[model samples]
Target: MWSDYLSAGFFKAFEASSGIKVNFTGIDSNEEIINKMKASKGRGIDICSPTNMRSPQWKNLELLQPFDYSKISTIKNANPAMLRVGHDEWNFGAKGSHWLPMIWGTEGIAWRTDQWAPPRAGDIPSYGDIWQSDVKGKTMMRVHSGMLGAGLYLETIGKLEPGAMKKAYDGEPGMRKTWQVVTDFCIANKKQVKLFWNDADSQKNGLLNDGVVVGQTWDGPPISMMNNDDPVQYRAPVEGALAWIDGMALSKQAENLDAVYEFLTYCYTPEVGGRSIDGGKDDSWGGKGHGYNSAVLGADQYASDDYGKTFGSVYPYKSLANLWPWPKEPQWYADVRTEYVNKFNAA
Candidate 1:
């Protein structure tokens, strides 16, 4: 897993300098993280990364605790907007932040550069493009998120009301109504997708080996390939990229308090945070960072030469302002979406 590689890289760097060994267990999904933490009562793990949207549920479940920011001087180096998320959104019963922003990223369009390009030069592609007739059976997507992308595309053509997808987060009825249209659209155009990707490796394989010409993929995989001079490019879609922040949270039953704080301080250092963006010179793990933005201020200054060029190209001409952050999701919402996703897949 890319996350495991990231944890390994961090462990190697921190261990070499601090003389403290860190053990890592990689999990593929948020559900797995919740399950493990719940089963252990958060006893075994010192820290775990969960998306910002999961903060509320996790906090309500008493799985995590607020951080003692006094020990983390590097907290001053984080972006203020991101800090507000920890302070305002994830502050569930605690007066302080239960979550600390780490890696932030987006999910958008990626295509084989030699085999495909946007319809017009200088313009970005749209989620609707994935279902275009020309690319039938040559596209790929993860079903759940892809369905949301499809919903956005439907609104663009007057097939659904504007903002219908975002409105679904209001409650269960809205969610079902919105997802019903999305599910129908996906079932009708299911033939367009060559394969469904569930992980980073599957996404890369779809493009590099499985004949996927274009895909709705997380920016990391294709950007990493692009850095290696592979004929692939990832960009924000015309509707907007789906954005998210993945953060570190303290386990409720955490025993290694000193080590947890030490690791947090190490992660926020400018040089370390920067290396995470550019995937530092560590050859053992393919020397590739996760290819996402870091939350730490000044971290970009320490990134590789390719970082600046790639950033400017991928988010050109004010596209950054258009990022659509994922909203906080309740357990009920997740369960409802799972039903629709299952229906679309089963179709």
Candidate 2:
């Protein structure tokens, strides 16, 4: 989506105005991009969008250069969470700076309002709820490893702990509880889930056409459907939702550092930010509103204009509690995936 827009007159205009031509390239995965950046030893691309989970990895590889805030005046207006300067031991150098939060969202339950009410505080539904006899064969889940890990954590540990909560990652009793819960839920509710979706459109179809009453998903799809007048609702559950950060960072080797800074400044503008929210379609998981909220543009007041009566009812990025920072450890992703795959296959 961003690539298409950048290729349009947007990049041309940006370049003409800033005297910097931005070169955009697409890579398959965060790991691939990181590896490519490391191979260059910090001289590859000017700007990259990698998941926040990779911050520590980039730091370790010395693939990022500290963001020069003095040159980017818009940094002051950004949400504090979006700032790059910070001291996190998990990041490389045991101290790191240089990745700016570009967008964010939570992984949580989305249910058919016609069939269910919002779960009360402390009563947010769990992965186990899908296994309840009443909803058997009527639930859906995301197939992504990160999302599945969160569901597993909620199931086994019953709630999120600040640090790594997986037994494989942290080797703690709480992690054990989380794994147990997820494993039990998957085993018992194997027949309940209609399907596990990897894409946003498939999940929407399952909910709208396949009679799926509950889904473990991100905020965009459910909210998009509801905005289009679908009988669905979503929320950040009491146990807290799995949050992630999608950020923009400069390549240590990027030749057009000035262009990268210009692009970052452009992205922070209200015009660019508003367009991002307005670009959301029902089938896409993340839309303009999702990006705007992640950029911390206050509440989602633009909904009424976008969806009419269907708009105001859907909440997007309203709670910091709902935003779970992605784990920084290198093996976190592989370990969690293995645990869930083992549990699911065993069941």
Candidate 3:
């Protein structure tokens, strides 16, 4: 779980009512949590917040239990767009039996507009922005071997054939070629990269301190910066933002299933979900400000409050066509990605 999601009073309010103590953990990325859950056999975890893309892999490992509608009373509030992304038979079962959509958002470029602006009038931003000569030596990028990096690569090079999502994770012959291209792209631009970051603070502060003119960030940090009058911008590139939804999953070995179920239901309520999205503590990114949007149905009501949008209040929701979740990857693909990640890090 991300601290950015579960804000200050979220659990305190829940505890005051339910008298249940939350033992929480913060995970860094999509890839790391999967490995952690599998290694622990999910011994200590009750509810897991993985993206819809992870449903297939979780199913393959039997890491999660099937959902039963009888246990969830709040399912009706989940809207269509939120439930539909990265969804499938295993996690959703016949009728969404395995998971509940928790938080959803896009990951893409966050740039310093004061330092880096469009090269020409009416020129839209794209993944190619980091490679521009003006922004060189002042760029950063996401360090991922999963869908985020792979999707950007495929989309950037116009190599996203149909089923390209699976190929991104599964190491199809196409994956090798696609990854090679991305690797080459990164290597050629590595000199421009100040750092490849996984820590949240580094990403947010890098932009805040003006360390890099352009780089990768989630929708949150940019919004946070702008709220404080920092001149940062997060936008969908010409290639489109990398979309994802993190949901609550049940661990097979969870000891207190009933309590965890109740907790999930409690959290789904609009007030709690809203507070969770817009929390008491301010991270460098959205919190007290909504860093990004959430999948919880009523949670997004704060769009009217308007965190830091100068273009207008609230994010202009993109077309469903523009978003893509991380592909559900197979084990073989995961292994190949690990190798590629190793090579990438070594480089």
Candidate 4:
């Protein structure tokens, strides 16, 4: 999946000049990939792209190789938020550059323009809106446990209870309120929700087919849909959206060190970074080069024709600059996913 969109020509050009063949393999899921790496005793794969939340597993399994940034030149160009060298011990030692930030984005709402009015500036809708009877069956949401876990937080918004946030994160309070809101919305609007989607393509199709008036989705999908001639719009909402920072790291068992470095270097190059930000490709890996909005180009040469207006206004890059990155706690992910799944199932 990661290799399909990589500019073959760009890699081939690198190979022609560097005499290194990039051996790319496709894996079906994170679990399968982890199993394969473990089975190999950390000797097969050269590099791995894992969520920060999964770092503890890799560290505990001894599957990750400590990165030596002394050999890499692109680290200087990396965004400070994207770089996590000295943050903590689990983060590849304080100075060892094992994990390299790859992409960053937020999870938010995407709605059909035909069905909903454009939200006023600073008036973004939130999870609470999904429970409104008016739009009940008209909504769809991500079924992933990580995303649904956000519901627990949502339920505490208007409550007078103390420690609600901590309770939700701890999975004690559970996602009861969030589930109630979502289930009530879904049940009332049973006829409106055309389908629930687990993938981007499905969400786009739902929006296009008029199956869903609004849905919880990542920033990328709605942007891509609007670019593809769909009337979808995205918003961060008042409650704030979820953010993630995925990074790249070399495997402890990797045999092709030079090839791995070459690949990382290629990814960090200005051209590659620019293309990734401009939506030149689809995969999540490339999109991290630029910020959330497709309009902000690190290099002027890479900007699209309407870059000036489109990048800032539609995407809201300036506002996101101050937002915090998701914490790199593995247990947080586990707890959230579990609570989300439980609440979703109950709903």
Best by TM-score: 1
Residues 174-250, candidate 4, lDDT per residue (tens digit)? 53544445444344444444466665556667777756788776665676565555777776655556666556667
Which digits, one per residue and each the tens of the lDDT, describe model 1 over residues 1-347? 13532745666778987888877777666777788888998888889888888775676788788999999978888788998899988887756898888888899999999999989667588898899999999999988889999999899999889999999999999889889989999999899999998778888899999999998999888888888899998999988999998888898888999888888888888888888776654454346577888898989987777799999888877789999889998888889999999998898
- Output the lDDT of residue 116, model 3: 78
Task: Indicate whether candidate 1 or candidate 3 has the larger lDDT.
Answer: 1
Q: What TM-score goes with each of the models?
A: 0.95, 0.69, 0.84, 0.74
Q: How accurate is candidate 4 locally (lDDT)?
A: 0.56
lDDT of each: 0.85, 0.58, 0.65, 0.56
TM-score of 1: 0.95
Give me the displacement of residue 171 in model 1, in angstroms.
1.7
Residue 171 lDDT (model 1): 93
lDDT of 2 at 62: 64
Which digits, one per residue and each the tens of the lDDT, describe model 3 over residues 1-347? Answer: 86456654666777887999888888777677788888998888887777676655666677778666567687666766666553454544454457667777777677887777755334446666776677777877766632344446456567555455446565568667766666666665666677676756677878877488887677666765666667777766555667777777788888997888678778667656655555523432234634656566766553335433432322344423575555565666666666666666788
Please tell me which model should have the higher TM-score, number 1 or number 4: 1
Deviation in Å, model 4, residue 73 alpha carbon: 1.8
Task: Please give the range of 10 consecutive residues that has the lowest summed lDDT in model 4.
Answer: 288-297
Candidate 2's C-alpha runs over 4 A off are 1-45, 84-91, 94-96, 114-126, 144-169, 172-181, 209-211, 279-292, 296-333, 336-339, 342-347
Question: Which digits, one per residue and each the tens of the lDDT, describe model 2 over residues 1-347?
Answer: 22222323445546676877655665534656666676777575677677666655555566666677677767655667555423343244544456776656566778887886544553355544555677878888764443454455554553544343534345445545556555665666578778777556666887889888987876667866765668887666544567666677766677776667777787766444444444433323234333224463532332235643333333333445444555655555445555666777656
Off by over 4 Å in 3: 84-87, 92-96, 120-123, 145-171, 280-290, 302-304, 307-321
